[model samples]
Target: MKVRLGFVANSLSLWDASPAKTITYKRYTELPKEERMDRLQEVTRLNLEHTKRILYLCAAHEIELYRLSSSLVPLATHPEVEWDFHTPFKKEWRELGDLIKKFGIRASFHPNQFTLFTSPRQHVTDNAVKDMVYHYRMLEYMGIEDHSVINIHIGGSYGDKEETLGRFHENLKVLPTHVKEIMTLENDDKTYTVEETLAVCQKENIPMVLDIHHHEANLSERPLEDYLEAIFATWEKRDLVPKIHISSPKSEKAFRSHADLVDAGFVEGFFKTLKTFDQDVDFMIEAKHKDLAMLKLIEDLSTIRGVKRISGGALEW
Candidate 1:
């Protein structure tokens, strides 16, 4: 199909200027349970507003792949803690299903950072799979045909790559067929890169969600194009690579500052190289400013592709 560009909603709440706003990771974690719910209600309402803005951007230039975070649906029962963020079966999920159709966006529910596939905790991985699987089933049961994806990290590289891949393979076999089909893997900041991720995906017959920034940040020794080519080559049988996590990398900032937007240089160079690739890909901008990052990325794509700014065109340049 067509290539798409969108944003991650995880950092969208950082823009709220409410005096008592506690939608942040710090405030949400430490705030009393009662206070967390109150603030979450406020942020949840704001999420709808943000969705409207996001839809406008995607509609303006016909961007594809709206990468949505699970946090967008507020858990009124337990909104603060990260554990409760995985509420795929919640009532809000049904509402979100309708909203995805309403907005006409192909949405994917991105799992939380705490949902590590190789966590030391016994239940961390199982519970993570539960949340991810639940999201796919709920939307499917709702008859939402927009095509959703659950993006995941290949867990910590830890010591041995082959050993970790073995465990990951076992875990994939346990996943339900529907959930397994919807699952895609992304390169993490520490353990994995697009190439390594593709290796695991190739073995398991799953697709990949390439994060350009993650590979660069992890002391990657290869050229950017090499990584991209390897991933596409490995998944040559697939018609489309579902999603990519893009953002401006702030070397000095932590994930908390994930919103720190990257400039146009990387975006410009990257999309240009993409034109040579034969595979179709969808993208998500994971910046401190998701909406703005998407807008800038679209603009850069248009400039690089040398296309007139037309409404509802898949490629920008």
Candidate 2:
């Protein structure tokens, strides 16, 4: 089994390189009318510059998987804000895509929790569609929309799983077919289990991004191994390797929270189980330490017998 490892947005190893800097709506409204656009442009420019720097860092380190910060453009999906984020940064967007293609990075976006289709409210569903379009537009601007994916959770049950899931299917119809084609759903830490999420993915003909941490916290009646093959099979049609989220708990008391770093021991069994399939997978580390945690996990896993450090961010066993 070979695994390519990556981390979420921002790199602790790099100073002031956060791609998620933003201005709240209140702050935007507070700014003088003349300065609001300037402020947005300034923050977005910095975010994009920082993102490019981080991409360079990834390329240097052979890190091939990365989650783009959804907040790359401030107030991008705000109901009142109207700005052309793409026109101003056309070259920047293309540069990022060029670097990603050159380095063979599997770029993706995970919209915030609010971007969901399970809501009963019409406005919530409308906003979800707007948010999805915003993310898709970023990918489009980068010229990577065809290959890159936008991942999101199945969303809240809203006092009823079956009804909410039904509503989710109904609400999801509002999304454009092209955007929906590249969408992948993930299992959440509280609401959806792997089995449930997998079933939904299968029903909708969508890929699934499994989060082991969420599965560990909210387990299904059956072991994860029971659904592992099916979960992976969901990606076969997409022609992309299955992507998994990896993170250890903060502590026994805070089992749902991510730790600063991944403990190989905590996920050793998962590795063992995955090895049986002998499939290559990409792992997105969701630890608090970001890139540092991804590197540390790779180091820790490389020490295990039969595991080879294939690259700065990959391992084969």
Candidate 3:
């Protein structure tokens, strides 16, 4: 069995390297009309450059999995301020893509919680579609739409789980088929459980990203072992490996909150269950410490008797 570990956006190890820097709508409006576009472009350029630097850092350290910041382009999906973010930075986008391909990095995007299809309101669904298109455009510009995925949750139940799920299926029709092809559904820390999310994924033929932390906070009726195989099977038809999210709780009381770093001991049992399947998987660390937590977990896991440190971000057992 092999596991490739990665972290979310913003490396704590790097100074001033956040790829999610942004300007508020209020602040944007405060700028002089003529300088609005310039300001947006300037912030986007810095974010992109920071992302490029992070990619270089990952490549140097043999970290092949990365989640791109969804805020790469400021006000990208803002109804009042939609703008062409690609034309001005065509070369920059291509360069990022080139580096990703060259280094074999598994890139992805996770839109904010609001970017979901289970909403009861039509405008919310419209906003969801628009948000998805924005993420798709980023991957398209990078020429990685075919391989990269855009992950999102099933969304709020809206006081009715069954009805909302039905509405979710119905609302999803608005998304383009090509965009849906690379989409994956994840079991959130609230609202949806693994079984519910997995059933939806199976029916929709979409991949499921198991977030173990969320699973612990919000469990299914059956033990994870019972559906572990099915969860991994969801990725069999996809081009990429099955991916999971990893994080430790903040405390016993605040179990749903992510801690500063991953507690290797806390996830030992989950690793044991995964080892039973003997399949390769990718772990996206959601710890607040980001890359540092991923590296620390890798080091901790490598100490196990049968586990080998294959790379800075990968382990084999």
Instruction: Mark the regions of model 3 whose C-alpha exceeds 4 Å error after superposition.
Output: none
Q: What's the CA RMSD of model 1 in angstroms?
A: 5.4
Q: Is candidate 1 or candidate 3 better by TM-score?
A: 3
Model 2, span 1-317: residue lDDT tens: 88999988899999989999999999999989999999999999999999999999999899999999999999888879958999889999999999889999999999989999998889999998988999999999998998889999999998999999999899999999999999999998999999899989999999999999999999998999999899899998889999999999999999999999999999989998899999899999999999999999999989988899999999999
Clashing pairs in 3: none
- TM-score, each model? 0.73, 0.98, 0.99
Candidate order, TM-score descending: 3, 2, 1
Please give, for residues 211-279, the per-residue lDDT of candidate 3 as tens digits: 999999999999998988898899987857899999999999999999999999989899988898998
- Over 153-196, each residue of candidate 1 has an lDDT whose tens digit, in order, gives 87774688777777777666656776777677788778776667
Least well predicted 10-residue stretch by lDDT in candidate 3: 232-241
Colliding pairs, model 2 = none
Q: Is candidate 1 or candidate 2 better by TM-score?
A: 2
lDDT for model 1 comes to: 0.62
Which lDDT values do the candidates have, in the order given?
0.62, 0.93, 0.94
lDDT ranking of the models: 3, 2, 1
> Residue 44's C-alpha lDDT in candidate 2?
96
